[model samples]
Target: MNKTINQKAWFFVVPVFVLVAFNAVIPLMTVVNYSFQETFGNNVFMWEGTRWFKQILQSERFHAALGRQFLFTGIILVIQIPLGIAIALSMPKEGPWVSVCLVLMSMPLLIPWNVVGAMWNIFALPEIGFLGHTLNGLGFDYNFTQQIGDAWFTTILMDVWHWTSLVVLLSYAGLMSIQPAYYQAAEIDGASRWSVFRYIELPKMKKVLTIAILLRFMDSFMIYTEPFVLTGGGPGNATAFLSIDLVKMALGQFDLGPAAAMSLIYFFIVLLVCWVFYNLMMKNEEQS
Candidate 1:
């Protein structure tokens, strides 16, 4: 006799599919529509084929913005991942102080993005801000508003302080998930701390590190609010990344066509990078 399989589980997933279609698929389709068309108010739209895409691809502005976006993301990943892992390793694995350390590590992440920017803006003032005053006292001519280098330093440092905790949290979770038997085996073999970390801990933590890197990459690439609030993409457009440039084109100058095309390209680059990361991570896991 043949057995019948239950097919009623479809009901459970249908709502999610419908919701995603409404929220993501429809909006993406609308963007694709605008990306290929030209508009000049009064709901007027003309078919422009790939004109906008061609324009964005040829524009030096987009090239510069793309370069800045990738640079920001690269810097963030380089700094945050190792730093977070080190911090997480230093924290007490199990003790009364663990909670306190975790809470302190998390405090910066709780602050709102715009507020973080505003706080940094005030705190970096040459005369009034404590940080600026302290840096100046230490013989560094740090002034985020007036100097391009200072602006870059403040932005990178602010991002580090704000988001590094996320990496720490993820690393800590991964570290905690390792079974005690692994440690026991390492100890039995008289493994040094470095040997244990290299052979046992690093492998276990790879999955989490992959996730942390991807999150940091995407967030840094798409960052707008804090940098915008802090710099206004000023200091001579030094902090103007792709998102900022897209906003300026779409809303500031009302060049919807180029903006829409650029946005689509921007979205695809992110998706492609994320896909590559996922594949590489899985391949590494398989090899290990």
Candidate 2:
């Protein structure tokens, strides 16, 4: 006997497809058009071929910004993932405090990004800001606005403060999903905490951890508003990640072609990293 598949679901999905194409595809095509052409005034555009792409690819400023962007993302992932897991591990598995802890963990994620940046900016000022005042009072020369090291430190610290909660929540959910039978079996076998985690919890949490890493990587890689509001890509271009540099090229200097090309390259880099990392993760899962 042959089975028939219903095609009526297409009627419900067409609107969503059209909406997505309008919102996503049209803008992307606009960017592609802008990337290959130059506009001086009005809506006029002249064909420039691949000159903008080559110029952006060869530019030292682009290289520096790209390096900084990667470095920031690397540092964020390194710190946030382990730290989030540790926090999740230490939390009470069953208690009234669970709700409280979850609420606290979620608070940071709820704050507006620009507000978080401004809050940190004011909070870290050396004169009246509590953090800076305390550090300076402790005999430390800490001025993020004036010093490169301090600026980078503050940027990294701010991101960790803001996004680590996402990792913690994801890890905690993974931990919560492990069956009690696994722990009982581990206990019967005299499995140490490390052994239990290694054999059971770690493996169980692999999917969530993969999700957490990918999310953090993409967010950190594309970060702009917070750091731009916080440091304004300042301390002499030290914190000027790719997003900030792209904005500078497009709006600050009115270089639309190069900016559009850079944006596409930026999009490709994110896509490539996510693709490679996700494939490697899936490959490991399949092997195990």
Candidate 3:
């Protein structure tokens, strides 16, 4: 005889569905509406079809911002992933220091995003900030406020400092979950440090590393507040990524139509990249 399913379980899911609709679906629908129409105060709208999308896709400003956004994401991924893994590898496996190291690793991740930005802003001021003053005193011309290279370097350094902890924590967790038998077997085989890491730890950490990379990629791509606070997208728009440019268009200049279109495009690009990353990483897991 077939067992009957409990219909009551469906009732429990209603709240989550309602919450998601209220938070995500409704706002997305509003954006979709604005993307195809133009408004001039008083809720009045005129159908503009795909004019805004066409314009945003054709604009050099959008292209430049997109390039900068991609570059930032690429740079962060290159730095954070390997550094995080190396740090995780170096941490004590069993000791009081484990707790202390974990706590220290977690501190950066706990800070608020806006506060992190503000802290970096003050910390990087050329004359008064500790980092800026030290660099300048060392005979290096380090002025993030006025130089494009300095702005990029400071921004990347701030991001790596804040987010690398997340990767380390995740990697450490992945490392801890491996069975001792794996290491015992590797030892019996006389595997070197690099060999054990290559054959055992790396494979085991694949899923967590995939997750870390995706998280870093998405966060880096969508980053705005920190860079905005630190640089104000200045030094002649050197650091104005897609999100900053979108805000500038939508609110700064009140060009809502193009902004909405660009946002949708930006959303799709992120979704596509994340999908590809997840699939490729998962495929490697299957092959291994």
TM-score of every model versus the real structure: 0.90, 0.94, 0.95
Model 2 segments more than 4 A misplaced: 1-9, 280-288
* Residue 128 miss distance in model 3 (angstroms): 0.5
Over 4 Å off, model 3: 281-288
Tens-digit lDDT track for model 2 on 166-200?
Answer: 99999999999999999999999999999987899
lDDT of 3 by residue, 2-77 (tens): 9998899999999999999999999899899999999876889999999999999999999999999999999999
Q: Of the pair 1 and 2, which is ahead by lDDT? A: 2
lDDT of each: 0.91, 0.94, 0.95
Give the Cα error of residue 68 in candidate 1, in Å: 0.8
Residue pairs with backbone atoms closer than 3 Å in model 3 (clashes) = none
Q: On residues 1-288, what C-alpha lDDT tens digit does candidate 1 reach at each position? A: 997888998899999999999999998998899999888978899999999999999988899999988888898889999999999888889989989989999999899999999998888888889899999989998888889889888999889989999999999998999999999999999999999889988899999999899889989999999999888887888888889989999999988878889999999999999999999889878876
**Backbone atom clashes (below 3 Å) for every candidate:** 0, 0, 0
Best by TM-score: 3
The better candidate by TM-score, 2 or 3, is 3
